[model samples]
Target: MANHKSAIKKIRSDERKRLRNRYQHKTARTHIKKLLTTKDKEEAQLLLKVVHGMIDKLTKKNIIHKNNAARKKSRLAKYVNKLVATA
Candidate 1:
Protein backbone atom coordinates (compact mmCIF):
# COMPACT_ATOMS: atom_id res chain seq x y z
CA MET A 1 0.00 0.00 0.00
CA ALA A 2 2.97 2.30 0.58
CA ASN A 3 3.93 4.06 -2.66
CA HIS A 4 7.29 5.55 -1.69
CA LYS A 5 10.38 3.68 -0.48
CA SER A 6 10.60 5.88 2.58
CA ALA A 7 6.95 5.22 3.36
CA ILE A 8 7.50 1.49 3.16
CA LYS A 9 10.47 1.72 5.49
CA LYS A 10 8.43 3.82 7.88
CA ILE A 11 5.72 1.20 7.97
CA ARG A 12 8.21 -1.52 8.81
CA SER A 13 9.85 0.55 11.51
CA ASP A 14 6.50 1.48 12.98
CA GLU A 15 5.48 -2.16 13.23
CA ARG A 16 8.70 -3.01 15.05
CA LYS A 17 8.27 -0.12 17.46
CA ARG A 18 4.67 -1.08 18.07
CA LEU A 19 5.60 -4.62 19.01
CA ARG A 20 8.41 -3.42 21.27
CA ASN A 21 6.12 -0.97 23.03
CA ARG A 22 3.49 -3.62 23.53
CA TYR A 23 6.02 -5.98 25.03
CA GLN A 24 7.33 -3.35 27.43
CA HIS A 25 3.82 -2.30 28.45
CA LYS A 26 2.76 -5.91 29.06
CA THR A 27 5.91 -6.60 31.06
CA ALA A 28 5.28 -3.57 33.26
CA ARG A 29 1.69 -4.61 33.88
CA THR A 30 2.78 -8.14 34.77
CA HIS A 31 5.28 -6.79 37.28
CA ILE A 32 2.67 -4.49 38.77
CA LYS A 33 0.23 -7.38 39.17
CA LYS A 34 2.90 -9.48 40.83
CA LEU A 35 3.70 -6.62 43.20
CA LEU A 36 0.05 -6.22 44.09
CA THR A 37 -0.33 -9.92 44.93
CA THR A 38 2.88 -10.09 46.96
CA LYS A 39 2.44 -10.26 50.75
CA ASP A 40 6.03 -9.57 51.78
CA LYS A 41 6.69 -5.90 52.34
CA GLU A 42 10.39 -6.17 51.46
CA GLU A 43 9.70 -8.02 48.21
CA ALA A 44 6.94 -5.63 47.29
CA GLN A 45 9.24 -2.68 47.92
CA LEU A 46 11.81 -4.15 45.57
CA LEU A 47 9.16 -4.82 42.95
CA LEU A 48 7.87 -1.27 43.36
CA LYS A 49 11.30 0.06 42.49
CA VAL A 50 11.47 -2.10 39.39
CA VAL A 51 7.95 -1.21 38.33
CA HIS A 52 8.63 2.48 38.85
CA GLY A 53 11.62 2.25 36.57
CA MET A 54 9.57 0.49 33.92
CA ILE A 55 6.82 3.10 34.16
CA ASP A 56 9.34 5.92 33.89
CA LYS A 57 10.79 4.33 30.81
CA LEU A 58 7.36 3.96 29.25
CA THR A 59 6.63 7.62 29.92
CA LYS A 60 9.98 8.59 28.47
CA LYS A 61 9.23 6.59 25.33
CA ASN A 62 5.78 8.18 25.07
CA ILE A 63 4.21 4.75 25.32
CA ILE A 64 2.17 6.04 28.29
CA HIS A 65 1.20 9.51 29.43
CA LYS A 66 3.27 11.17 32.18
CA ASN A 67 0.20 11.61 34.35
CA ASN A 68 -0.79 7.99 33.90
CA ALA A 69 2.70 6.87 34.86
CA ALA A 70 2.65 9.13 37.92
CA ARG A 71 -0.72 7.73 38.98
CA LYS A 72 0.49 4.18 38.63
CA LYS A 73 3.65 4.88 40.64
CA SER A 74 1.66 6.66 43.32
CA ARG A 75 -0.84 3.84 43.70
CA LEU A 76 1.90 1.22 43.79
CA ALA A 77 3.78 3.15 46.47
CA LYS A 78 0.64 3.52 48.49
CA TYR A 79 -0.05 -0.18 48.23
CA VAL A 80 3.47 -1.02 49.30
CA ASN A 81 3.21 1.40 52.22
CA LYS A 82 -0.02 -0.19 53.32
CA LEU A 83 1.61 -3.57 53.17
CA VAL A 84 4.47 -2.31 55.27
CA ALA A 85 2.10 -0.81 57.80
CA THR A 86 0.17 -4.04 58.03
CA ALA A 87 3.25 -6.14 58.56
Candidate 2:
Protein backbone atom coordinates (compact mmCIF):
# COMPACT_ATOMS: atom_id res chain seq x y z
CA MET A 1 0.00 0.00 0.00
CA ALA A 2 1.24 3.48 -0.72
CA ASN A 3 1.46 5.36 2.57
CA HIS A 4 2.38 8.79 1.29
CA LYS A 5 0.03 10.99 -0.75
CA SER A 6 2.65 11.43 -3.46
CA ALA A 7 3.15 7.70 -3.65
CA ILE A 8 -0.57 7.17 -4.01
CA LYS A 9 -0.72 9.66 -6.85
CA LYS A 10 2.22 7.99 -8.49
CA ILE A 11 0.49 4.65 -8.25
CA ARG A 12 -2.59 6.04 -9.93
CA SER A 13 -0.53 7.54 -12.72
CA ASP A 14 1.28 4.25 -13.18
CA GLU A 15 -1.95 2.36 -13.49
CA ARG A 16 -3.24 4.75 -16.12
CA LYS A 17 -0.01 4.50 -18.09
CA ARG A 18 -0.06 0.72 -17.86
CA LEU A 19 -3.54 0.57 -19.30
CA ARG A 20 -2.60 2.97 -22.09
CA ASN A 21 0.46 0.95 -22.99
CA ARG A 22 -1.50 -2.29 -22.97
CA TYR A 23 -4.09 -0.87 -25.34
CA GLN A 24 -1.44 0.36 -27.73
CA HIS A 25 0.41 -2.95 -27.60
CA LYS A 26 -2.73 -4.93 -28.26
CA THR A 27 -3.60 -2.70 -31.18
CA ALA A 28 -0.11 -3.14 -32.61
CA ARG A 29 -0.36 -6.92 -32.28
CA THR A 30 -3.69 -6.97 -34.06
CA HIS A 31 -2.32 -4.86 -36.89
CA ILE A 32 0.64 -7.18 -37.27
CA LYS A 33 -1.61 -10.20 -37.31
CA LYS A 34 -3.76 -8.66 -39.99
CA LEU A 35 -0.68 -7.89 -42.06
CA LEU A 36 0.54 -11.48 -41.78
CA THR A 37 -2.83 -12.97 -42.61
CA THR A 38 -3.28 -10.83 -45.70
CA LYS A 39 -2.91 -12.89 -48.91
CA ASP A 40 -2.53 -10.00 -51.35
CA LYS A 41 0.99 -8.62 -51.56
CA GLU A 42 -0.15 -5.06 -52.24
CA GLU A 43 -2.55 -5.07 -49.33
CA ALA A 44 -0.01 -6.68 -47.06
CA GLN A 45 2.57 -4.10 -48.04
CA LEU A 46 0.15 -1.30 -47.29
CA LEU A 47 -0.66 -2.81 -43.92
CA LEU A 48 3.02 -3.38 -43.28
CA LYS A 49 3.68 0.31 -43.79
CA VAL A 50 1.07 1.15 -41.19
CA VAL A 51 2.50 -1.44 -38.82
CA HIS A 52 5.97 -0.03 -39.30
CA GLY A 53 4.73 3.41 -38.35
CA MET A 54 2.98 2.04 -35.29
CA ILE A 55 6.13 0.20 -34.21
CA ASP A 56 8.21 3.31 -34.60
CA LYS A 57 5.73 5.29 -32.53
CA LEU A 58 5.81 2.64 -29.83
CA THR A 59 9.59 2.75 -29.75
CA LYS A 60 9.61 6.54 -29.58
CA LYS A 61 7.12 6.47 -26.73
CA ASN A 62 9.30 3.89 -24.89
CA ILE A 63 6.51 1.32 -24.89
CA ILE A 64 8.93 -1.15 -26.58
CA HIS A 65 12.65 -1.21 -27.16
CA LYS A 66 13.95 0.23 -30.42
CA ASN A 67 15.82 -2.98 -31.23
CA ASN A 68 12.75 -5.06 -30.59
CA ALA A 69 10.73 -2.81 -32.87
CA ALA A 70 13.44 -3.01 -35.53
CA ARG A 71 13.56 -6.79 -35.33
CA LYS A 72 9.81 -7.10 -35.72
CA LYS A 73 9.82 -4.73 -38.69
CA SER A 74 12.63 -6.67 -40.34
CA ARG A 75 10.87 -10.01 -39.96
CA LEU A 76 7.54 -8.63 -41.10
CA ALA A 77 9.14 -7.01 -44.13
CA LYS A 78 10.90 -10.26 -44.98
CA TYR A 79 7.68 -12.19 -44.76
CA VAL A 80 5.91 -9.65 -46.95
CA ASN A 81 8.71 -9.82 -49.51
CA LYS A 82 8.55 -13.61 -49.64
CA LEU A 83 4.83 -13.49 -50.19
CA VAL A 84 5.24 -10.99 -52.98
CA ALA A 85 7.85 -13.20 -54.64
CA THR A 86 5.61 -16.25 -54.40
CA ALA A 87 2.54 -14.45 -55.73
Tell me the deviation in Å of residue 80 in model 2. Answer: 1.2
lDDT per model vs. reference: 0.94, 0.93
Question: What ranges in model 1 sit over 4 Å off?
Answer: 85-87
Give the TM-score of each candidate.
Answer: 0.95, 0.91
Instruction: State the lDDT at 38 in candidate 2.
Output: 88
The alpha-carbon deviation from the true structure for residue 73 of candidate 1, after best TM-score superposition, in angstroms, is: 0.4
Quote the lDDT for 14 in model 1: 100
Q: What lDDT tens digits, residue by residue, belong to model 2 across residues 15-42?
A: 9999999999999999999998988888
List CA RMSD, all candidates.
Answer: 1.4, 1.7
lDDT of 1: 0.94
Error of 2 at 9 (Å): 0.6
